[model samples]
Target: MKFLVLGATGATGGLFVEQATAAGHEVVVFVRNPAKLTPRDRLAVVAGDVRDARALAEAMHGTDAVVSTLGLGKAKDPANLIADSTRALVEAAEEGGTKRLVIMSAFGVGESLPKGSAILRFLYKGGRATFADKAAGEQILTASPLDWTLVYPVLLTGKPSTENVRAIDLAELDRLPGLPRISRADVAAFLLATAVEGSWSRRTAVLTTGR
Candidate 1:
């Protein structure tokens, strides 16, 4: 399958690119700066912002699916980024006739916030617009006519791939503390699997590292 991966310069996104290529899938990456990613076979790079629908649509051409790990890293205002980018991606996908999408989201965003501890909820709420934007992005996906999956992972680490990941429903957020962290490599693995198998279609999957 062919894949258009957003945020391919990120740690987990880089892993997704490498792993997806290794899995015998064609991978296309969209990035503003290509220096962050090393050139590799079966990996095509399209220089552009995810917010640019025309550029994104150009990259989306002939791709079988899309995986967006587009992260908002301490922007002055992150409230509109993911939501707006998601809107652009959805439109680009629709225009290109692509159907599948997998989005990487954080634990305390959207409906998952209600399932977290009061302290966690308080902290996320303190962020004001960040989580709200994520929720809006999620709503966009849920309301779209495409096949989409939202993956929520808690406390990401740079540790080696454990390959042992756990996914639970929103009702099980209390169990999160027990499984506090997950490796980016493992997160990449799950994302790749989601793109290929579409296992969690139209669902939200909260991920952790455990058997």
Candidate 2:
């Protein structure tokens, strides 16, 4: 499979790139700084802003799926990044005749906001702008006709891949315990699997390392 990846230089995105390329899938990374990623087999980099539909459409060629690991860098960062990118991504997909989109979102965004744990809710209050942006982006995605999978991961960590990630439905929110967490590697693994296996299409799942 060939993938067009956004945010491929970030923590989770980088791990996804490594894992995908290692598994023999062709990858095309859309990044602002292509130099950050070392060239390797089955991996290619295209330089551009994620919000640029023209560039994104150009990169969409022969892409089996599109994966995004985009996230806010800081609380103070402008929150429009994800929303803007999603807008462009949808347009690019429409123009390129691509349908599959797998994105890494947080557990507190969109419909899952009120279902977050107490501590997580508190943090979200402090980072409301960031989460709101994600919600806006999710709105744009859900409105589209494309086959999209939204993985709302809980608090992310840098721990190695445990390969024991669980995909919980929003209806099962009450069954969850305290603030759950999943590693970037695990998130990457699930994102890759979700795209390649065509699982969880047009659905939103909460990703946790817990059983």
Candidate 3:
């Protein structure tokens, strides 16, 4: 499978690229600065802004699946960047005939907040802007006909892959216990599995290190 990863420059995104390539899948990373990623086998870099639909469409040509790990890291400003990039991906995917799409979202975005655990709701209280931005982006993807899987991972950590990650749907949250978090490596593994196995089609799942 050929994957076009949108946030290859980020922590989780970089992990995904490495994992995907290690698994023998071809990977393409769209980034503003290609030099940030050292060239690796089975990896191709496409340089461009995420909001450019025409450029994204060109990159999406022959892409088997598109994965977005894009996020604003500590730039407290409220820019609807997620929404803007999502719009471009949706348009580019439509134009390029790419069907499978996987997106990284947080636990409190959209209905995840209301349907989430108490701890999740409280933790995201001060992240109104960020959550809203992610929700807006998710709204666009949800409305599309593509095979999309929205992954809502609770607070991410830098730990190595637990290899015990659980992908739980919203209704099954009650089955999970305590304050949940997942390692970026685990998230990357799940994202790659979800795309490759064609699982969780058109559904939103909450990812966590089940206790």
**Number of the candidate with higher lDDT, 2 or 3:** 2
| Tens digit of per-residue lDDT, candidate 3, span 1-211 | 9999998999999999999999999998999999899999999999999999999999988889999899998877658899999999999999999999999988878776777667767777889999888888889998999899999888899998889987888755653445778899999999999999899999988988864
Number of the top candidate by lDDT? 2
Q: What's model 3's lDDT at 140?
A: 94
Compared with the true structure, the alpha-carbon lDDT of candidate 2 equals 0.90
Candidate 1, after superposition: displacement of residue 149 in Å? 0.5
Q: What lDDT does each candidate get?
A: 0.86, 0.90, 0.89
TM-score of each candidate?
Answer: 0.92, 0.96, 0.95
User: Tens-digit lDDT track for model 1 on 1-211?
Assistant: 9999998988888989999999889999999998888999899988987788888999999998999898877675785988889999998988999999999999988667767666666667666577788888888888999999989988799999988899986654554553368999999999998889988888888997776
Alpha-carbon RMSD of each model: 1.9, 1.2, 1.5
Q: Rank the candidates by TM-score, best first.
A: 2, 3, 1
Q: Write the per-residue lDDT of candidate 2 for residues 1-211, one digit (tens) a residue.
A: 9999998989999999999999999999999998899999999889998899989999999999999998777657655999999999999999998899999888887678778767788877877778888889989999999999999888899999998988987666764568888999999999999999999999988999867
At residue 97, what lDDT does model 3 achieve?
97
Off by over 4 Å in 3: 171-177
TM-score of 2: 0.96
**Which residue pairs show collisions in model 1?**
none
